[model samples]
Target: MDAETLPPHVVRTAPGQYEATLPGGTLRMSMRQEELPLPEICDFALRHNARRRFLFVSRVLGRHMPTRPAAMQDVASRLADKISIDPADGPVLFVGMAETATTLAQTVYAAWCRRGGQGLYIESTRRPTGGPIAFEFVESHSHAMAHLVHLPSPEDDPENLFTTARRVVVVDDEATTGRTALGLVASYAAWRGIAPESLRRELAVLARWMTDAQSTESEFTAFHSLVEGSFEFVETGVFAEAPPAVPHPDRAGLARRGTRHGLSHPQPLPWQLDVSPGHRILVIGTGEYGYQPLLLAADLEARGAIAWVQATTRSPVLPGGAIGHVRSFPALSGERHTEFLYNVPEDHGYDRVLLCCEDVLPPLEHPIHHISRLEVLPLPGTLTS
Candidate 1:
């Protein structure tokens, strides 16, 4: 098999240090594994949050960057290959961190299904429900901190999903400090009235990058990933007010529910992007819902156009190092909030740029300059049907 190519901006700076340049700014990342190249898996980006200074933007996540569906599926498949499922390990429960890795985790569960294995897919969300809250945890570094785990209905055997499972496989796009996972396990420990050290866990981590200070208190039998390493974020002392962000955890929850039970909600305005042969296009999905634009990108790709998909985020990051550049825009909700896209280079422009949002329409002027066409279309249910 031929080795795939890494993005041009991915460069090794020094021993255990690599720089990933995106349009936002260059990120100086620290890695523990010399064998795992940074660019092949992910790139570094600065974070805009007051608590954290940087973000490790994923390339295959099909979230921040536009990627093909097949490629995204391949990543999940590859990650699954690294995990060894033993019948002796007993029944397992797969937990996907909300918003970002929900889909990635679902794909992993799908992989298990292929092997005729059984597992219940559980996800952590910021959304609340009238149902009982299984547990709640905070993603301290994220723009939104509160995450709630609501179990499925009793008819689906929610009790069995938790009690019968001997292990919890937590999945996330990448681990920066690993505190998020720690918080998760800690929350789980409290919910079950079990000691944190007593849980049998296996981290099906995507990017297993952890700093020296990261928590490793685990009963996990295995740690698996397509790549493993860490990055160093150097903040420029640049501070600013971010745009108003809507977690829309409800939409994320609905999508997961829809996928499981074949339910579909009202979609945002149905808009079409006219594509021509050999056009390099970009479709941007707003907030936590990237699945819609992902399907759009797939349609564009099937039509012979080189279509790429990415999403807008409320996370604050400083520019420089790994991120080549940063572009800011008025939040879709209004001027009250600010949104950003990183790693866009001045040199590489697209033919068409399409914006898809779940709830609000963003100002269309800032991100893509000199593009032949720019269209702002509200995603299904985000606007008039």
Candidate 2:
């Protein structure tokens, strides 16, 4: 993830302040740019949480942006190629940070499996499953601080995916201070009664922007990423706060659908979307219910459409960095929280942008408000999550 001479992507906006030129617009921010090209991978945004004045928003993570499914697969495959484990290596478990990195982690785990690596994908969630709790950790900066790690037990791990596990690989979008990842591994190590020095552990991310998050001279701990470097964020303490974020979905429908509890494969709803084949299609998942959208994308691809799945997020970011564009509209969750999609093309972004939601159809004027060539296609059935 280290580069020799990447061009600077951040520009000084004002005295002691900077702006990242994202794909969409100039994101006003202040960062002491380090050796890394800050805007190439991500940009800064104001956070609703007062403790953390800014947020390192990613372009390709698809949380605040709409990204192609194949592109995500490409990233996962490329990352899989980088992670190597000898057959003699112990069982591995990949932990994807919930809400943000769940899908990304699953994508990498899927690729890892294709590469003949043995691993189970478990993610930390704010939602409680009422099942066995493996361990827990804290992300102090996140709006949702509490995290639950649900591990598979003897009955679920017939293959000994848990018992034989000696390695832990944590995946995330970006590493700001690296404390979260380090803390997670430390907690897991304590739970297993093993010293952190006893096992192989690595923190993987798309961008290594945090200086503290960078790799140091240690074999016991390592950091890997698609792009690695550092940026300086000089929070002016004058940024506007985003509106309150809706808490993680906990509706009975979403819980039954396993929105929070980790899923090897999201249970598919027996429903379908009708669209033309062979076209480059964009399917938008409303809110955090993205698994269903991915399933829909796979089905569309199988039906001859070059399909990709992306979603609107409750998280608000000042546009820029990989965020070429941002589409702001009311969400279909019936919560009235603002929804956003980043870097979607203007005219030719895609042949069609299908707004997919579980239940509570968006208003008739919603889709046309932000996107053209849009169709409000309801994913059949009373869906929630």
TM-score of each: 0.72, 0.71
- The lDDT per prediction is 0.62, 0.63
| Model 2 lDDT, full chain set | 0.63
Q: Which stretches of candidate 1 lie above 4 Å from their native place?
A: 1-10, 13-36, 129-132, 154-163, 215-219, 230-279, 299-303, 319-385
Best by TM-score: 1
Q: How do the residues 1-385 of candidate 2 rate in per-residue lDDT, one tens digit apiece?
A: 2233322556654443555543323445444432333444454554456565456665455566555566566666667777786766677877888667766777777778777777666777655556767787888766556677776654445566654567778888877567788788888888888887777778788765545554542643566677654444454334565454334433322222243434443245445767677788887776555655766677788888988777776556664344456677765655534566765757745887777665657666664345778876665564433
Candidate 2 ranges with C-alpha deviation above 4 Å: 1-45, 153-156, 210-220, 235-237, 241-254, 257-273, 278-280, 286-292, 298-306, 318-385
Number of clashes recorded per candidate: 42, 10
Model 2, C-alpha of 83: deviation from truth (Å): 1.1
The residue-by-residue lDDT of candidate 1 on 1-385, one tens digit each, is 1123544666666666666665444566666653345565665555665556557667777665556666766778777776667777676777778668865776676666676666666667654434666777778667766777775665554447565667777878877556677678778778888876776676776687667776563445567677666655544354576533344343322322322211112122255566798988888766555656766776788888988877766555666444566666654444344566655555548787776665545444544433346677664455331
